[model samples]
Target: MNITLAQAEKAIATAKEKAKAIDAKMNITVVDAGANLVAFGRMDGAWLGSLDISIKKAKTARYFDMNTGIVGELSQPGGSLYNIEHSNGGLITFPGGVPIKNTKGEIIGAIGVSGSSVDNDHTVAEAGSKAI
Candidate 1:
């Protein structure tokens, strides 16, 4: 499965809308199945530091085909994947990343959001994922 430009745009838009709803300024990113960037947006007043984190969050989700939070939980100290984040040039193991799936249940891409609380970011990313 692949993500077209329109789909990427839609995801970003939805993520931004959700962020606004939560009174957050966020950086959002979309990546295709191949873990390549497809689209990205930074809301005005978002943290500059979160730009790379947003992109990495999307890549982390696409690369593992799972939400970043689950990965974080799994990879915690003494967990099954302890220190796994240190691999693949590091990963954003916290919340705010989700896979984009097609009707056939195939992951077509992923969305990531940053510049907010992890819970809020996860919600925004979910909004974007659902839009796709």
Candidate 2:
């Protein structure tokens, strides 16, 4: 199953709310099951450098079927899945990415957030995932 347009919009809205709650300007990106862009939102004053990071975070989560933070944890030096970020044109291995699952527990899409600290990014991304 893939994420519908409405779901994507809902996710973006929630993400924006979370960012605002934290007084953060964020770049949020959502992607479908096939890792295609579904929706995106950039809060005012968001860092320009985070645009691609947000997209790549969503892509990374969808590509691996795991949160980017988990990937980052296991991808550390001498850890499992290490060094694979160098493949696929270099993937983001940090936090701020999550898979969106359907009611039946199927992954439908992914959400990514950037333009803040890693902890804040993860928090905002998790908020967006709730819209699934």
Candidate 3:
């Protein structure tokens, strides 16, 4: 099943709260299973660079049907599918992107965030997913 607007809104709200808690502005993006954008937000004062990175991370999660951290590991030197990272607009081979799974463990979409440390980005993304 596809991600609904309600889910997107929940994700955005949670992301905003987490970003506020850390006192860090952020760019958050949600993408459907097919890597299509569902929703996006740029917190005030967030770095412009995070705009693109957040989308790329969401796309990475959507494409891989898993967290971007797992994809990053798979793309490391001597790892399988290392070349895959070079495709699709150059997704960053790092953490901070996470998949959103339904109750049956099916991935319906993903969320990503940037404009902070990778750890903080991951925390926000996780918060968003949990909110959904």
Q: Residues 1-132, candidate 3, lDDT per residue (tens digit)? A: 878878988998999998999999999999887889999999999999989999999889888777788888888779897867679878865777889887777888999899999889989999998886
Shift of residue 113 alpha carbon in model 1, Å? 0.6
The residue-level lDDT of candidate 2 at 46 comes to 98
- Tens digit per residue, CA lDDT, model 2, 6-103: 99999999999999999999999999999999999888899998999999999999999999999998889899888878977778989999999999
Deviation (Å) of 78 in candidate 3: 3.0
User: Each model's number of backbone clashes?
Assistant: 0, 0, 0
How many steric clashes does model 1 contain? 0
Candidate 1 to truth, TM: 0.97
Off by over 4 Å in 3: none
CA lDDT, every model vs. true structure: 0.93, 0.93, 0.87
Measured by TM-score, the strongest candidate is 1
Clashing pairs in 1: none
Predictions ranked by TM-score, top down? 1, 2, 3
